[model samples]
Target: MNPLTRFLSELQEVSLLIWRAFISIFSYPRYYAETIKQMDLIGVGSLPIVLLTGFFTGGVLVLQVFPTLQYYSIQNEAGNSVATSLIRELGPVLSALMVSGRIGAAISAELGSMVVSQQIDAMRALGTDPIRRLVLPRIFSLVVMLPLLTVACDILGLIGGGVVASSIYNQDYHVFATSVRVGISTSDLVSGLIKPLFFGLIIGAVACHKGLSTTGGTAGVGRSTTDAVVIASIWVIIFDFFLSKALQYLLDLGQL
Candidate 1:
């Protein structure tokens, strides 16, 4: 009944839930089809927001950095800073946040509704595992799509930064391209790509769990939806810290 004990209990439950979700993938072919559907729902449905967010994010970064670069007389390094910042961190972080807000909210709401309707219980009575049927597909979909979505974000973000850098910042296009090429490494891009994969998994898992735990009436479903979003967003930021440390360790060890 102590706080620490409760926390440990919750942690154990989460670990078991994750294990069961992973096992469900191989145990059910229908889960794969459901996962593919969730992927499209989460990934493709997020493209508009991701593109808009990525474009403006790049534009804003260019806007912020170019003036600073000019003031410091490092105008030539404008593209270098922009490219490295986008490819290494900003692109994936922002894209995941955007998608998390969009997709995470929806998943929580849908599943919460199922719980409220007792549909989840109905499925259980029919000899189906709810985690395998509902949660695993979403978890798998998110883990698969986030990296691909991050790639799209990285490309669009770079192009947006390039446009502003050349057209407004007066940096040469070729110079910007070369600087980005040299300043951003494969590892830098990989770092950006990696965060979103984990983000997807965490976001999906948290949302689905919250949804499954929803209680009371319609009010509870709404609360669960809000809680899911807030928790998923916070988890993404928290995971980013650990991910950065891990990536830094890898880079230091020349394993990146």
Candidate 2:
């Protein structure tokens, strides 16, 4: 097939997946309940990793950039750059990637196991829709959890950056705070939050797709889980680039 046709066919599959989930959502209250459960599992359960990753990411980012700022005689602007980058990009994307490594793998493993064990078939036999009962909840949970997790990451990451800047670099905390306050805007924060929401959806959907397609047996579950994480991470990076570019363009256009 031509590349154009192949692309269109893949696009159609994605649209159909979204459409099926969208239509099924209206008829399924239980799916929402499962979403809440999954929120705790996917969100609350992943908090430690998220927190640890964010803290280190922020500290490292500040450390790496601090020397550049000092060399440029812009040491005073360290906090502004850190805060702007974290709130506008790093916080959400880093947190999402971290969570995807943890939660995404588990989600795929669980669902793939169900498929392998015929539990999904049992659900079908019982007149329950696996997509609604299983996949939808996960998708919804991810969408909700990722943004909240990003907020936590932003706060924690900024604090970590402040710690490193003040303690190690001898930058004053008050100066750092003021720079952050000046540099980071509500829109910047919101943009970070927005990107992660889509990131969450992609992670969950990709995980579900891999799980639902699992073959073989126990080994298949493991493979599918790994594949889910790999696919989700790649898609997250791709989406982040596009989202960043799109947002930057819109912001520039708006300024005009």
Model 2, residue pairs in steric clash: none
Q: Candidate 1: lDDT over CA atoms?
A: 0.82
List residue ranges in candidate 2 displaced over 4 A: 1-14, 253-256
lDDT tens digits by residue: candidate 2, 192-255: 8889899998888888877887999999999999988998898899999999888877654123
Against the true structure, what is every candidate's RMSD? 2.2, 2.4
Assess every candidate by TM-score: 0.93, 0.92
| lDDT per residue (tens digit) for residues 1-256 in model 1 | 9989976875676667788888776764466677788888988988888888778787788888888888988877767787777777877788888878888889889999999999999999999889988888888888888888887877788788889998887789898788778777777877877788889888888888778889997899999899888978988898888898898788652332
For model 1, where is the 10-residue window of minimal lDDT? 247-256
The global C-alpha lDDT for each of the candidates, from Candidate 1 onward, is 0.82, 0.85
Error of 1 at 100 (Å): 1.3
Query: What TM-score would candidate 2 get against the native?
Result: 0.92
Residue 247's lDDT within candidate 1 is 89
How displaced is residue 179 in candidate 2, in Å? 0.8
